[model samples]
Target: MKRLFAFLFAALMLAPAVQAAEAPDVLIRRLSTEMIDRIRADEQLQSGNLARMSELVDSVLMPHVNFQRMTALAVGRNWRGASPEQQKQLMTEFRALLLRTYAGALASAKDQSVRMKPMRADPADKEVIVRSEVVQPRGGEPIQLDYRLEKAGDGWKVFDVNVLGVWLVQTYRSQFAQEVSANGIDGLIRSLVEKNRSAGAAGTR
Candidate 1:
């Protein structure tokens, strides 16, 4: 489960930074290639060194992801019910979880490459699916990577990634909804916060 979360986080962090002047497909391929290169080159990430992996994720990945949007989707209808403070806490904890999980997955990056599929998307639509293939070593089946993209301002931002056809946000949504149902939104937020805190302490130790 942790490894699966890490793979999703790493993929999310590498979402294409679309340029105004470039086609979305071209930009996605370029950014994805660059991210793969960075992962390959980083000694700490390649070696599964946690401290450097954490730093790499914080510096290179976090800025590109829309955590607030992800949190809202994950929290489902409970997002509207939360107070501002609670909303802020939820976003913070969720962000930390992704970052930590991404660091953990850096070890699995070896010999893995992403192949961007041809985009058959309507330019007029604000939202579209961008598909790719993750080729792993050992000659097994390729993992399908589908990114859910939304036009935000002048560029397209990815809100979710589907690995091997399983949507990450949707998976989290189910878990989050269950948590909220069992203990309310506040309880869910508290649980995430405590989990983040515990992970942080464990890393320090």
Candidate 2:
């Protein structure tokens, strides 16, 4: 559960957006506006009182993400070596990890706003870095957010995020590699399942 939540927060730090001629601020504002409206309209989510934030996150945020591609990249060379069954298991676990993560992080979405920085680059570039700040109501300080985006067919998709300068995909790659090395793929799967089960039990209470 902790791992999943970590991943979702990392993702939120770098939300995806189209790579049109539109300015970064315009894209960010559009996404933020849509999200706020969805939050208010969903009865199940609104009544869940933050507990149900996961539902909203899963429905709205998950659609824009490319988790399958992200997982393949994270697995790196190991993905090529994995058998069909192993590949399937890895995808399942990865998806669950993100789902549980989205649920938890959305629950904590208090009064927050995003400030997008100016975009500076040619449209032909294969990648663009979208910078923003997540301002919280508590007034501690704004969190630095950076989205590493890649040009997909007719659009730009987020492949990685850095929060307060910490790159999420890199962090998971290191940790996941260590776990696989220490316990093997089966061991890693077991660990994810156990953690997910525990989180489910807790959510019920």
Candidate 3:
């Protein structure tokens, strides 16, 4: 699961705020290429500078993703039961967790490029799947990576990802559901808080 999450972070790369006019597949291909080039050229990023990577991710990647939707999906049915404030807290903590993990993945990225497969979606569709793979260094087996994106007013926002046939939202759904079941929404929030806190401490050390 951890490896798959890493694959997802690597596959997303560093995407700048996207233009609404760009096609989803085009967006993926362009950003994937850009990220590979940037990683290869930047010594600080290649060395795994967490702070720099985290800042880049916030500025470049967050705008392209629908993290609130992702948090709701991961929380499953419990999403409807939580108060608005709880939902907000959940989103905050969940975003922190993902951001921390993504920063770590970015720092470790080296000599990796993404290969995008042909996407089959109608021009009028509101949601689409963009398929791709990560070509690892030294001729390693390419890992299958896919994205689920929905058309927002500004542009397409990625909501979920699939790695090695396992959808990220589904993978976390069961675990999050268990957490919510055992301790309620606040409990789940506390769990995510502790996780992000631990990751933050570890990164600083």
Candidate 4:
């Protein structure tokens, strides 16, 4: 449920409209609208096809996210101690975990709408947080979501998410740290791989 909440925050908030110059809020608003419409129309997504949903996330959403930072933060202080190969492995597993977790959750976007608060940031600032609310259908209460983004060379990219006041990266960081401490870094990777595989298998069932 926490993973779904985190990804729902990402899917609804991290989208960037890359057509022209814009603030982070405008970019999010534009892409969220566009992607929400696309999700609504995609029969595969409506049917909860995880493969197709992952493809959508990879093609459309991954580019706008700062996965390197996310992976490092989730790995916590143990990251610098990891070898290059281990780092790569960690990133790969972390990426797979996110894609698999969020792919299934993406289907929940059906009939959801988002509203943004005023975006506050200096034009010269390199990073900022954007806040918004997701309105679920059938008169459900709105979910509070926030995105933390930094100005990469290409443009602003999301690195962490805050859902209902809890930070996404921080949440995963604690879990990753505990898992690595118990079984080791390689064990952490294996666990993530297994979780992703289970998600995939569940999708096929």
Best by TM-score: 3
Ranking by lDDT: 3, 4, 1, 2
Q: Candidate 4 — what's its lDDT?
A: 0.75
lDDT of 3 at 144: 88
Clashes per prediction?
Answer: 0, 1, 0, 0
| Residue lDDT tens for model 4, 4-103 | 4633634643354464356788777776677677677777765556666555656666567788888999899989888899899999888777766666
Residue 128, candidate 2: alpha-carbon lDDT: 75
lDDT of each: 0.72, 0.61, 0.81, 0.75
Better of 3 and 4 by lDDT: 3
Model 1 score (lDDT): 0.72
* Candidate No. with top lDDT: 3
Which ranges in model 1 have alpha carbons more than 4 Å from their true place? 1-8, 11-18, 48-63, 201-205
Candidate 3, residues 21-109: lDDT per residue as tens digits? 88989877877777777777888876667777667766776778888899999999999999999999998898778767766666445
lDDT of predicted model 3: 0.81
lDDT of 1 at 196: 83
The residue-by-residue lDDT of candidate 1 on 1-205, one tens digit each, is: 4554555456545544446555556656766676567667777665556666556556656444566787899888999999999999888888777777667566676567778888988879887888887777888678787777777776666677777778878888999999999999888988898888888788777
> Please, what are the lDDT tens digits per residue for candidate 2 over residues 113-170?
6667777768678877787776666785877777776766645556766777887677
Clashing pairs in 3: none
